[model samples]
Target chain A: MEITINQTPFKLPQGASIAEAIEIFGAEPPYAIALNLTFVHRQRYGETFLTQGDALEIVQPVAGG
Target chain B: MSLPENPDPLVLYGTSFPSRLLLGTAQYPSPEVLRQAVEVSGPSFLTVSLRRQAAGHNETGGQAFWDLLSTLKIPFLPNTAGCHTPEEVWTTAQMAREVFETPWIKLELIGDDYTLQPDTLEMVGVAERLLKDGFKVLPYCTEDLVLCRRLVDIGCEAIMPWAAPIGTGRGALNPYALRLLRERLTVPMLIDAGIGRPSHACEVMEWGFDGVLLNTAVAKAADPIRLAGAFKKAIEAGREAFLGGAMTQRETAAASTPILGTPFWHQNPS
Candidate 1:
C-alpha cells in the first residue's frame, strides 16, 4: 500500500498497521499523526489499519521563540 | 475622590496593553513550564517564530506549542528571525499570515553572522513589499535613526530598535543612539533585544521607549517564571516614572546645610 506523509508518498507492506509503517520508515517518534484528515492517537496506532492512497500527515514540534 | 495608582494603559499599534511586558515562548525546560511562566509573566503579547520541524518528533505528546498559545487566546507576534533575505522574510510573513490568520509580522533580516544585526537595506525592501501587500510590519533593526526613519517612510506600523545583539543579554549597549532614535522617530519604537534583567528593561522604558521585546532574558533565566513577573513590574514602574517625570540633575552643588555657619563651633570651645 502507498501512503503520503508530509506531502511525500511511500509504499508499505501488505496488512501493515500505522505502527508498523511508522517503525519501518523510522519516522521520528512522539509525533501527531493524521490519516485522511483524522487524527490517530499513538495508543490507537496498533489498531488503525492503513489503506492504499491514504494521506498521512506527521507533524513535529519546532522551536518557537 | 480616591485615585487609582496606575493609569495610562500601554498602547501598541492600536492595541491597549494591560501589562507593558512582552514574553517569549522558548528555551524552557519543558513546554508545561513555559506555559506556566507565560501565565506568570502576564504579558498581553507573546512572540513566536516560524520554522520547519522534522516529521514525527514531539516531546510534548504531539501538541504543538502554537496550538497551546491559540488555546490561551493571547495575541501572537510572529517573527522572521532566521531569515537572511527579503524573499525569505516575505515568504515567511505570507505563510504566517495564512497559518496564523494575522497580518502582523515581526520583520527581521540578519546581515552579519557575528552580531546577528539586521540588514537595513534588505529590511527596507521587504518592509515596502509587505506594506504594499497590506501587512502590518514591525521591523526589528539596529539603533539607527536613519534606518528607523526609512522604515517609517516605507509605511511600517512600528520600529523595534535593538539595544544590543539578539540574545546576548548584554543589556542596552547604545542608550545614546537609542535615545536619539527615540527622539527622532515619530512612530512607536520598542527596544527589542539584549535586555538581560528587569532593571535593564525598566531603564529602557524610563528612557521613553514605547515598549520592549525580549526572549533570552526570560527564557534563559535561572527562574523564568519569577523573572517574567519581575519584568512585568519593572516595565510598569519604568513607564510610570517616565510619565510622572523625574527630577533633573544640577551641575552646581547645593549645600544641604544652611550657608550661615555657627561661630566656628563657639570659637573651638576656647
Candidate 2:
C-alpha cells in the first residue's frame, strides 16, 4: 500500500504500522506524528496501522517567531 | 495600595520568570550565533515551531537545533504560527505539545496573508477549545479591546498583541488601542511581533506590558548577540522606569532650577 508521509508519497508493505512508516521516513529524534490531523501517541505507533493514501505528518522543532 | 514587595519576576498563569523578554529561534546568522544570543539575553522563554521532516533535508531539519536548544535549558513556548483555522490550530498545538512536552502554546491564526494579522473573529473560539484541552494558551491578537477581552473571557491567562505587522519592525502602530487594551485587561500582556529596535521593546514595556516577544529585531541585526544584550537591558530599564513613576505631562514648561535661586530669573506678567 502507498501512504503519504509529510505529504510525500511512499510505498509500504500491506498493514505497515506508523512505527514502520517512521522508520521508513528516517525521521530524526524529538519529532511527533499526526495521522490524518490527529495526534498519534508515541506508544501507539506500533499498533496503529496505515491504510492506502493515509496522510501522516512527521513534524520536528523548527525556528519560529 | 502599595505594589507587591517582589514584582520583579513577570508572572503568567502562576509561573514566574525573571526575564521579561522572550526570543524566537529563527533568522539568526548561524547556530553558533543563536546559541550565544540565547546565553546573553537570558530570555524567559524561547519560541519554536514544528515543520515536516522533508526528504533528504534532515541535515537542516532541526535535529541539530534541537540539540542546541536542549543544552541551553530555556523553557520552550511552541507556536502555531501558520494555522488559519481552529482545526489546524488544534492539530498543530497537539503536535507541539507532544514534541516540546510543554502545555504552553502561542496560538497564532493568520487571517490575512499580506499583513499576517490575527483573525480576531475566529481566534476566541480557537483559544477556548485549547483552554478546554488543558493547554495554557497565549493568543497572538490585535490591540483591540473587545477581542482581547473576549480572549480573557475564554480563559486565556496571557495575551500577545502585535506592536505592528509581523516582521515589519514598525513597532506599535496603535498606541491608543494598545493602551486601552492594557488598561482594560488585567491579564499579562506581551507585545509580540513588529518590534524593530530595543527602544521599541522599551516603549511598550514602559507602558506596563508584562513582556516582549520578538524574532526579527534581534535575529536580523548585524550583531545579533550584542543586540540581544541590548534588548535585555532595555527591557529591564523600561520596566524599572514604569515602576518608578514618570512625571506628568503638561502644556506649560516647568523649570528645574528654582526661580528664587536663578540669577536671571524673572516672572512674566499675564
Q: What is the C-alpha RMSD of each candidate to the true structure, in Å?
A: 7.6, 3.5
Provide the clashing-pair count of each candidate structure.
0, 0
- Give candidate 1 misplaced runs (Cα > 4 Å): A1-63, B1-7, B60-62, B252-270
TM per prediction: 0.76, 0.94
User: In candidate 1, what are the lDDT values of residues B1-270, reduced to their tens digit?
Assistant: 975643676666676667676677767777777787778877766777654334454553234665677676777777877888887677667656654567778888999989999997778988998889888788888888888888888787688888889888988998889877777877777788889999999998998887788789988988888888888889888888888887788999998888687557556755
Model 2, range B116-182, lDDT digits (tens) per residue?
Answer: 9999889999899999999999999999889999999889989999999999998889988888888
Those runs of model 2 whose alpha carbons end farther than 4 Å from true positions after fitting are B1-7, B57-60, B264-270
- C-alpha lDDT of all candidate models, in order: 0.76, 0.90
Query: Predicted candidate 1: interface RMSD?
Result: 7.7
What is candidate 2's lDDT per residue for A1-65, written digit by digit as tens?
Answer: 99998888999999999999999988778899899988888999999999998999999888888
TM-score of 2: 0.94
Instruction: Note the B-chain TM-score for every model.
Output: 0.89, 0.94
Error of 1 at B19 (Å): 2.4
Which residue pairs clash in candidate 1? none
